[model samples]
Target: DARVTQTPRHKVTEMGQEVTMRCQPILGHNTVFWYRQTMMQGLELLAYFRNRAPLDDSGMPKDRFSAEMPDATLATLKIQPSEPRDSAVYFCASGLVRSAQREETQYFGPGTRLLVL
Candidate 1:
């Protein structure tokens, strides 16, 4: 199965220590991203319909869904710890949204099944 393997393989790490998470894009596709609904940053009017800048997670609840765009070519989504809230990726769609292009129809992928405890 397609997956991402984070380095260190540890539950936690010391401050200043470098950590890396890696994943590969599906064949013939260039985007490998997801959206999460946390109690913090839940859907804010779907402001981010797609994983563009700020990786729109407006579809999320009001917990803590953190998203960032370190640069123009990379998008990152950070999952926060929640007791009663499940941080798993419920809906994952494919396709690209490049500049000056029409938005294409996206197909949903199966749930990541990532249950954080």
Candidate 2:
């Protein structure tokens, strides 16, 4: 299908629990960005992916957070042993690249809201 459908929605969980987030992609788009928002830091970029490959995830805590794209239409972010500081509204945004133009602006997903105690 050419339309985006059945993307993963929000989530809520307690502290120390594991959280897994998935994004059902839009057709033809090759890039995804994971972001999280909180009162202190506002919006922060947690991961960036392109062409079904993870290019950078420096913003996420290596010990707890992981981002991966197992295929072209699926992207995932996992947090193990989530902490209180990890509580935030996590969002997945996607975009398509055009050769003649700058990168298009990404649109956010339903957002997974995590409350880690």
TM-score of each: 0.42, 0.88
lDDT of 2 by residue, 19-51 (tens): 888886676888888999899999999998989
lDDT of each: 0.40, 0.81
Question: Model 1: per-residue lDDT, tens digit, 1-117?
Answer: 543322222224333332232222233443445544445765223223233444445554445454444543343444454433443333343456676777665544443333444
Any runs in candidate 2 off by more than 4 Å, and if so which? 1-8
**What is the TM-score of candidate 1?**
0.42
lDDT of 1: 0.40
Q: Where's the lowest-lDDT run of ten residues in candidate 1?
A: 16-25
- Root-mean-square deviation of every model: 7.4, 2.1
